[model samples]
Target: MDAGILFWKAFCENGESELIDLTTIEASMTDSVVATLPVINPSTYTKTISSPVVVIKSEYRRYHHALKASNEAMPINLLYGWGLIGYWGGVMFLGTLWKVGQWFYYLRFNKSKAKDIEKPNQSSQGELALPKSLAMLRHWILLYIVIPATIGTYHQRLFWWSNIPNRLDSLIVFGFWALSIILGFAGYDTFSGNPTVTSLPEQNWEMLSDRTAILSYACLCWLWMFSGRNNIFLWATGFSFQSFNIFHRHIARICTIYAIVHSIGYTVEWIVYYPKYFKSLKENWFIFGIVATIALSIMLGFSSVFLRQRSYEVFLVIHIVLALVVIVALFIHTSYFGTQYNGYLWPTVAIWCFDRFLRLVRLVYCNFSVFSGKAKTTNASVMYSSASDVIRIDLQPTASSLKGRPGQFYYLYQPYTLRGWENHPFTLGAFTNGFEDSSPNTPEIVKKKVTTTTTAQLSDSSDDAVKLKSYRSSSLSNTLTFWIRPYDGWTKRLRNECIKGGGVCYPKILIEGPYGHTQMLHTYDSITMIMGGTGIACAVPYVQDFLGKSKIAISYTSKIKLVWTVRQPEFVEEVCANDLSAAICDQRIEFEFYCSKKNVPTNISTSVHSSDEVTKQIIIQSGRAPVASLIAESGTEAKLSNSRAAVLVCGPAAMADEARAAVHQALKNGCRTLDYFEEAYGW
Candidate 1:
């Protein structure tokens, strides 16, 4: 026998079976195939062809297969059957119940609240619950409209039929999905396979089938999208039960379904069409790619909600690595020597990859563009905050590679440091041109500084590039500067050690990621951003952009209010004198500084005062802002009753909770709408 047959023979037998060992035949088979096989004794007749090559059917094996098929078929049928019936039924029943509940609550619970509503100064601070009619209507619209609309839109664009000429395929796919829902709702047999039901017109059956498949895929995305959104909302509302299910358990369930169906369905279909190719799955790169992706997807799909929740950091690293693996497999599977899929999904992936590459290129230029500019060598003095809480530090950037967004940060490094690329994130606090008219005493200080310094020495390449300029103009500067507040980490430890010895800590830094920012800025007519402590950094860049574009609104309520509670009034004075709030001088900007320590001196020289714009309207404590005050200033009884405006909040979770309650109360009184935005660093 050949080695292939022998190997198969070994795989077929087991310890329970009375069969001869296949290893005995390996020596015989290694050199040549057997012309005749060995015969078994009469007592060993059952073991004669015990190997898998023996095609004789077994009642035990048949029973096992039948049981498996029965098990598999039962759950699949039940899953589909229950999904169709339960989903639509639940939607209708819940919607009706919500409406009834709303009306009942409004009459029973809200009547007394209505009495309080007539008194604008009532002291009730709790956020009123959503009323019957509006809440019910919102549920209805969310379920029947937004949920289906986004899914349908995705279906139309992402289906295979979407690729056929004139979009015939996409139309058919969308039509099938619509028909499935309509028929299911009408109590028709949704699984019917009749040509009139399951199949489209003969004129375009192929395109129609492709369309139907595409629509099916969209239903999957819709399910996942809703799950993600639900997770976010539940998390926001402080409902731990719902948030846990939606974010962790429900996400895993949906991801598993998507992965299994995506793998098995296509794999089986391909196998049926080309049995030879399927048999060569291990040998074919295309098939291998699919297998690899499916395996990784399964692992990640489960690990995400389960293992990820336990150790988020570990899960994050593993997930990132697995994602890269899966993406690579997907790329190979799709390319397969170059073939395009008929959908937006693949094209979208390709586009996303291209965009990421472009972003990296832009980031590199942002860091090093000055180096390739007209000047080959430039000497610059940069001032930054050190650990001593003093503003001091000088830099000669032979090249200015540091350019970044206001709210964003960067890592820093110098050629003479331990490494040229070791850097850390520091907020770019201020930017200014190099001083032109240096005092006569400055060069003497510089010469002394260079002569006796072990750390002041620089590479020959960097030394030749350090030239001085005569004038200091903020507009003509090429150097990028940052203000850093060190914490208990590598950067902080190094800075502290260096400053303790009265030496400079100059090291190269590697910068990465400037991905997120405030989006949909133009969506509303008015905007307000509230920051706490270092959260101010997130608002600086956005505020600069808003002011620079002259988009500042005139309404007192439409303006951006900078409410920062610091320890000393001098901090507030420094901000005003530094021209931080210069653009908003006559532009209806309000600044409120709440001094936490009463003994701190109030050294502010500007005309701005705590009582000038917001005295009773604001409160500052050591922690978050007073949410009740924000609601009182921004909330409206009539708008709350009608649902008109939106309220967006971004800060700590606790702060967000207070803000949400206040806004919700205003909604119940009459705010037309309520919307909140929160930023998370990473998970």
Candidate 2:
């Protein structure tokens, strides 16, 4: 029967298992041998040696779990597991606290003034939708929470040693730190009392196990909250999953290092220095741990930024496969070790499963709808703007209603775009429910349209209201629009398809999300949007949403400014003509257009269009934007008039850096409370 026993018999008879030291390891029938040995690495079977004595298990009943088994401090180690529970709760607590303050600030500053509201339009709509800003939390968090925690976590370690070369060095140092925490492990030494015998070194295995329990718990946030749509992270931070990805990678690095160190400590103690170590090496628990660690290491390597950027498809494929393997291997590993660690592992599994379920539900809801007694996927009409190198797609929603806010991006999937599950994220450009809300589908030289509604009807008539609502609902397209700039892979493929036809292609597409932004722009008393080239996709939705509310004199966003820098004027040439007219007509808004190659438009400062006492015009200029002057202008206006101001920049890295510097300078000069936000694509 027992394989271990058979191995022992075989070894005694023919020396088949030569790896194990059979001479030193006596299969004793006696009580025990109280051997005096050096205390090196301690496990559960171990205790604090009075002087220098190793308690080696001589009696054996169960084959696998028989080696040096001890139930010492089981209750104590279980208590340590609760430390991980505290860590998860702590992060969630902070998120809730910060979100509370953001709500307060947004409600206080941005609201309709009542003076700007036109009497005719005010009664038609039920209420103006002005979502509050959650963006303000970052400013306070960056200074107080992030800065202090970062300093406390790593700064002290800097002074511990010097001459750190790079990030790799930091990872190695952290690994070493993980190893050094196991005290009383100062290399193997000979036992003078029992000169002939050698035993496994004693270490603080209890401490090692306790620390890693907390670490694995910390990692669950990255696995669940960072990627999941319905996570506490989204509610607390009010930012897209894109914004939280970086923090996920950082925490993952720490978690992996702890896991590797955990495996190493066990291997060194039981398999390396212990007498007759080969017997213990044949155990299943030790081998499962090794497999789990290797799988974790492979997953981390493939998920690195380099691999992800070079080829996302390959990274995603291998990443999921390796993650699955790690999960299965850990199930075996922990189940064998005992379920004390399942407090972390089981919850991680549950979170991952729930997230996948939500994703599947979202896909079906977005793509499937009943049309004429049959379920079908919605077809999207794609139109290419040759002048701007941007493709605008108008998607008819399957659902009766479509809703999204600024800064949210959707994962777009086209059947013919590429092969094997290819999806790209693009910002929500602009959308409309009815013709009144519908932006004019204009192409070439932004045009203007002026209409004076002189329909004089009683403001308090329910019949007219019902008629108006019914009429608008019948004509509602519920269109979801997105502007995608042509690039490599999917974009280039779509470009070729468009060029082959008459600048348009109607492809069946699937939509996955209506994600959220960090904060509502209405929170700021004054707001400036700096956009470079195609980065306007991120800003356009906010502009359109605010413009609608601004026309009816909605909420607190009174002073709005947009700074657009293009390589050539033709970049915006094919844009709707009405968009230009509407933007220029709004007195509450100002525009600064900079064209690098095109000369200044003749109407820069000479003439202005006036309709019904509203006068506005575009400020045309040559070359790049004057960042210093623009920022100085913002600061002066905020100090003189507004109590608070915000700058939102979505552009190339260089442009964003410039905007950030200017915003920083304004704050340093003691201007009104100014906050800066940028939308970057580094992920």
* Segments in model 1 whose C-alpha atoms lie over 4 Å from true places: 1-256, 261-295, 298-320, 328-349, 370-528, 541-560, 565-588, 593-623, 637-648, 672-683
Worst 10 residues of 1 by lDDT: 437-446
The candidate that wins on TM-score is 2
Give the Cα error of residue 143 in candidate 2, in Å.
6.3
| lDDT against the true structure, each candidate | 0.38, 0.56
Q: After superposition, how far is residue 27 of candidate 2 from its true place, in Å?
A: 31
Task: Give per-residue CA lDDT, model 1, range 1-683, as digits (tens).
Answer: 44334333433442233436656656655323433444333323565454432222353343334334323543443344445335434443544564555456435434544454434322221334356797567645433332221222221122332211112223323443454544223321222222222332321232222332233333332233232322222222222222222233332333344445445545544455335445656654567556544655555454543454355445545654664565456455555546542242353344445545654554454444343555333243432222112222232334343433344443344434554433334444333323321111111011111122322212221221122111222343444344333444444555565556443443333333333233333223344455544444455454544454332221112355566544433333333323243333435445555545553323222342221232111223333356557654655532443322333444443454455455545545544443344332112
Least well predicted 10-residue stretch by lDDT in candidate 2: 450-459
